[model samples]
Target: MFKNIISKQLYLLSYLIRWTLISIPVSVAIGSMVALFLWLLNWAIHFRFAHTWLLYLLPVAGVIIHLLYKLYGQSAERGNNLIIDEIHQPGAGVPKRMAPLILVTTVITHLFGGSAGREGTAVQIGGSIANLFGSWFKLNEADKKIILTAGVAAGFGAVFGTPLTGTIFALEVIAIGRIQYNALLPCLIAGLVGDVTVSAWGVHHTLYHIDVTDVSGQFYGKHLPVSFLLLAKVLIASALFGLTSMAFAKAVHQVKSIALKVIRINWLIPVCGGIIIILLTFLLGKPDYLGLGVDAGYPNAITIVSSFHQGGADFFSWLWKLIYTSVTLGTGFKGGEVTPLFYIGSTLGNTLAGILNAPVSLFAALGFIAVFAGATNTPLACTLMGIELFGGEYALFFAVACFTAYFFSGEGGIYAAQRVAAAKTDDNYLKKIFSKYRP
Candidate 1:
């Protein structure tokens, strides 16, 4: 028994030391690349703002993007899905070119005013880098998955400056209703190290705050300081947030299918998409929905941060962002859906708060993470994200909103490669209930 105990302790210590050493360099590589991408992305977005004529060249940009993929993209065109598929099955290695292909295409997408996010690009970079390193190290298949998870954790954490959320997200995003805890230590080490590496490079992430507190003057039970009525409001709003996520996912998927079918010429799909985006800009008489809503060229623009205040967003801001992002991404634009989801959620939360008579900032904060949680099926990570970005004052409310949104959001998500480890709701449960005795 003592010998067994000694052997176990030795094994555990070796495991810790091994992963720690491995995670640091992986984190540093991923973090450095992500920092570079963010810098280039910033310059691209600002340059487009300086010269709005680039918007007119969007069709040309789209053609270039399609051609780049057609000529050299190959498996790299799969983007994040390819990485996820590689994680699930370890053959057909992630190409070294994936890093540059996604990095360049994503910048081009944003530079030309295509509405998309950077998270997917960062993640692909991380995965590709990890895959490359895995090859050099000649690690076994199982070890490769662990290192890849760490890479994902590093990329997400470094990009957002939220290490804990990154760790959880890396674990939870692989499959719904399940998490790969075996990778926990490596992911945590990578996430923390990666975030530090980015900050070390002087890259700053967006700041968000929750300006209102909903603690009632009267306390409930022995320790509950929040009002039950406010919780009730959150429940209602979270359900709506879930439905909105479903709508966004379904809209993007259907639009992509329809556009691909209708435009048999292939590359013309994005061309038509670019033309439609131009028409929409004229139709709306504003360019507010053309890029990542984090920053706008025009004054008084509604953004994720702006939605935290009352009257900051139009009643239809959420809908417009959804439509804009759906069209941009569904028609072959290369970027992530997360930031647009953030814009949609916060704006929608702003509208709902007004109708619910709740605190605008609080609801917006909840919506920001809750909608992402619903869409990505990563409630725990989003709950931590709320704490990281805002504060822990509303942790309970954050969990409530995120988990409720998760259940209601269904199993479909932005990543088609994601598998359902467990169904959210067994569709045949009712049938089983009715025929239980017969069976």
Candidate 2:
């Protein structure tokens, strides 16, 4: 027994050493290159060409995307789906043409003010690059998956500068109930290396600012009643927030289905959506809600938060954003939905926080996690992200709100291909559809 234990320990130690030696430097180099490309891409798109209205150039944008898709065929249509496909099928790596095509299309989308996020574009680039390495190295099927996961972590870490969260995301996102433990070391290495490289290049991230109170502080003791009440409010808020998020996701999916059914042209969906966005912008008299809504974070900006006390942000601010983002993403715009969810959540959370007389900072934090949990169906990841971004002071409240949101959000999510390993209820179709695919 002693000999077997000693041999097992030695084997584990050797594996760890080998992985560390291989992963660190490789991740660092790959991360640095990806960061540089993304930095250049963002600046060029935002400054050089963002002024171009989507309505004016949307036809051309449609032409380009259609041409690319027609050229690449169905493989191009599988952008992020390619990642999920690769995980399910080993010999499949993302096509070499994917990176350039996505980069070009995404740049065009952003430059023309198509509502979108940048992280999806970066992840495609990073994953495609790592796919090349796996193919060249003739890595085994398992290692191929590992490298792809590491690539995702690297890309997310580089963009967000949250290595730990990125690492967890890579591991947790592969499937709902199962995690690939073998992918952990590689993801950690890639995430850490990517964040370090991005920071070294002077890229900065927005930190969530909140006041922390000690567990035993006099103020906390006095505020205990309020805190408990706030927790209850958060739970209620998160439930409603989850329903809103799920509605947005399902609405986009439904629109895409309708577009595909009604417009057999296939290429006109995004163009039509773009036209609607333009019409909405004219009708609403504000373009602030048209894009990714990052400007919401700016001081004195026309954000939902700023207008909360003044009777909410222009009735359609949130709804317009939801429509633009949904159409932009669902109709094949290349970007992430996570950032937009944050925007929506913050807007809604801030409004409720004001009504309940809760701290804005606390509500903002809750909003961040609750929306994220609902959108991604990643309650645990959102909980950890809250703790990491908001400090440990509100861990209890954060966890409660996150899970509540997740439950209310149900089986639907931003990622349609996400596997449902287990369900809280046997009545749902999640069990029927996903039981066969659980890995």
Candidate 3:
């Protein structure tokens, strides 16, 4: 019995060792590609700003992007959703062309001042690279899934510089309220390697700070560490953040449907979107709602960093960002929604802190991760992200905001391919009622 047990343990160790080795190269490739993409993205943003007149050519750029995709994108146009679908149910596999198509088109979108993010583009690069590697090695279906998960981990980790969050996100993102432990080891290895590789390329992620000096208040004749009032405020703000996430998701889908219905020609959809964006920019009197919204290197510019201070963002800034991103992505622009979501959440949180009389930075930090958690249906991952980005000084509050946002955000998410493995809330009665009416 002892000899048999030892042999079984040795086989398991060998299996893990093999996968770990495979994940290293996969993650290194992903991280290197993401670094290159980020470098180009930064260049495009600066170039567009340098020549503000380029904004007027956005419609033309959109038309070109549309034609290019229609001609050669094929199933690659599905983007992150396609990767998610393959992970859930292995199919034709992620196309190799997806990486280049998304990279070039995303840069074009940013170059012309489109409101979008880079997560989707990086993820596509990672997934495409991993799938190609898997095919080269003739990996079976099960191993293919693990390889894809590792790719996602590498992409997310490298882009955002959060390996733990990236690992959990890759495992949790495929199914709502479910995690694939089978791929945990590979995902961890990939996330760590990817983050390290990106850093090795001299890339740096944005920094955020949260002040907790006044987070403590006396309560009920005892000196409590954290203020009860602050917790209450966090709960309320997180609920609003969740609702905003739902609104953004619904609006994106609705706008896409309306655009397709109104426009007979597919390519013209982005043209109209570009025109509308220009009009909105003129009306708003500033181009703050465009591009990544991380930083623009201009004083008093509304950005994720600016939203952490007082009087940095205006009321309804989040709403405007939601509209801009919805229209840009709805009209078939090539980019991700995460950076925009961060802008929306932080700005909205800044506004709420003014109303609630809470610490602006703390609330902004909470909204930053909570809204993403709600939108992506990955509360645990987002909670970890909060800790990674803002430190663990307010971990309990982070958990509260993230979990609450996840609950209130409803079933809709940015990734339609994500499956509902478990019901978030008890709906047995609703399910029974609907079942009785089924044909």
Over the stretch 54-125, how does candidate 1's per-residue lDDT look in tens digits? Answer: 999888888899999899898999888888888788878788888888889889999999999988988888
TM-score list, all predictions:
0.96, 0.87, 0.97
Residue 43 lDDT, candidate 3, scale 0-100: 93
- Pairs with backbone N, CA or C atoms under 3 Å apart (clashes), candidate 3: none
Q: Against the unseen true structure, what C-alpha lDDT does each candidate score?
A: 0.90, 0.71, 0.93
Best by TM-score: 3
Model 3 over residues 338-411: C-alpha lDDT tens digits?
98999999999999999999889988888899889999999999999999999988899899999999999999
> Which consecutive 10 residues in model 2 have the weakest lDDT in total?
212-221
RMSD of 3: 2.6
